[model samples]
Target: MEERKDINRLKVVLAEKKRTNKWLAETLGKDQATVSKWCTNTSQPSLEMLMRIAEALEVDMKDLLWPLKQQ
Candidate 1:
């Protein structure tokens, strides 16, 4: 059996919230480039940072993640 990794859905959530990477960057005290990386899924935020982002975006942690596929 192959193991599957869950996908990141941060960019979609940000768009649904009508927010920008710059706004998230300011909210988290991070650089826009870093936020851009996260939004693009070029890099992922640490679990701790993910929690902070959820708080900043006023969203549930699960909101940042894509739902896992059922076998």
Candidate 2:
């Protein structure tokens, strides 16, 4: 089993919501490039940003960071 931190909940949440980078950016009042980075895991959001993200996505903050078993 290969476990890597690259597996993030952001991508899954975005996909489940059918949200695009542009949509997330507009909702978060951020740049699309920044949202793109977040989705691609190139950068991580700050705690404050994560709170906003959880709210915007209608998910609990814990859900946004819930780790999975290594696979």
Candidate 3:
């Protein structure tokens, strides 16, 4: 079986921002479980949702995504 990759950096960003998944969920009016999924990389948010997340987090959209290449 193929290994799963962590694409979104939600967990790290949340930690850096001192925010919790539940707080984000409530802010977005979404279910906590869904926010947990996005944080764990078990699933990803849609582009539109990503925009909302960025807006709520006060960060750029690209900040939520894991960089494909390291500098």
Question: Highest TM-score, which number?
Answer: 3
Q: Per-prediction TM-score, please?
A: 0.81, 0.80, 0.88
Candidate 1 C-alpha error for residue 44, in Å: 0.3
lDDT tens per residue, model 1, 1-71: 99646457888889989999999999999999999988887889999999999998888998798654689
- lDDT, candidate 2, residue 3? 58
Clashes of 2: 0
lDDT of 2 by residue, 1-71 (tens): 98557635888888888987789899988999998888778888999999999999998887778755689
Score residue 63 of candidate 3 by CA lDDT.
Answer: 88
Between prediction 1 and prediction 2, the one with superior TM-score is 1
Candidate 3 residue-wise lDDT, 1-71, digit = tens:
99878889899889989999999999999999999999988899999999999999998989899654676
* Minimal lDDT window, size 10, model 1: 3-12
RMSD of each: 3.8, 3.5, 1.7
lDDT of each: 0.87, 0.84, 0.92
Q: Could you give the candidate ranking by TM-score, starting with the highest?
A: 3, 1, 2
Model 1 pairs whose backbones collide: none
Can you tell me which runs of candidate 3 are displaced by over 4 Å?
A: 67-71
RMSD of 1: 3.8
